[model samples]
Target: MEGILIFAPFFLIPYIMAHIFNRVNYSNRWMTYIFSGIVNLAYSVLFDFISSYLKEDKSQPVCHFPLFLFPIFFSPFLILLQFMFNKAIIKSVKYKRNDSQNEQ
Candidate 1:
């Protein structure tokens, strides 16, 4: 339960962003990938900054470049998930349209 709470944002944020993109009808593959990467990078930096600030070690550097790289390294996988999510949303919308059409 506690662990899920910690990790939930990592998954949820991308999914929510994908949904918003879909809602706005922005389906460009490269754009989606780049946007998700930037969002994840910002999130990683902010989280690290807060955690480090709360720690007692004022001597340690707050910005860890390697930690920032994780988002870039895993962006392909994240983009793949976003693609799938977008496809699923599209399919659902199509299904609803078809249902309404058949009723009419």
Candidate 2:
């Protein structure tokens, strides 16, 4: 739908970026968390701005500002998920190497 089209990037990009960063084993998990949160907030604000501009409405939605804070919840969760993801990737790579060495 139209709503999904507008909001998908706000939710999706940070998740994907976090996952990618995790795979690379980034040292600063907190920085990544904050970066993702800010990105999410910016995207959400942009979505609201675009919607309001298209609708030609001067009235600001009450939920918009509150919604910006939603990223706070995701920040910690994203950091944990990234940590897990990095561990998994490291394990998988080690397992693959071990298996290859065993065959040779």
Clashing residue pairs in all predictions, respectively, total 0, 0
- TM-score for candidate 1, please give it: 0.64
Summarize candidate 2's per-residue lDDT along 1-104 as a digit string, tens digits: 75685556545655566565655534554455566666777776777666656875558653456445545555566566555544543333333345766777
Question: Highest TM-score: which candidate?
Answer: 1
lDDT digits (tens) for residues 1-104 of candidate 1: 53463345557766776677665644353465567778788877776666667889888666667657767777777777777766665333333245766777
Residue 87 lDDT in model 1? 68
Listed in order, each prediction's TM-score against the native is 0.64, 0.51
TM-score of 2: 0.51
Q: Supply candidate 2's per-residue lDDT for 49.
A: 66
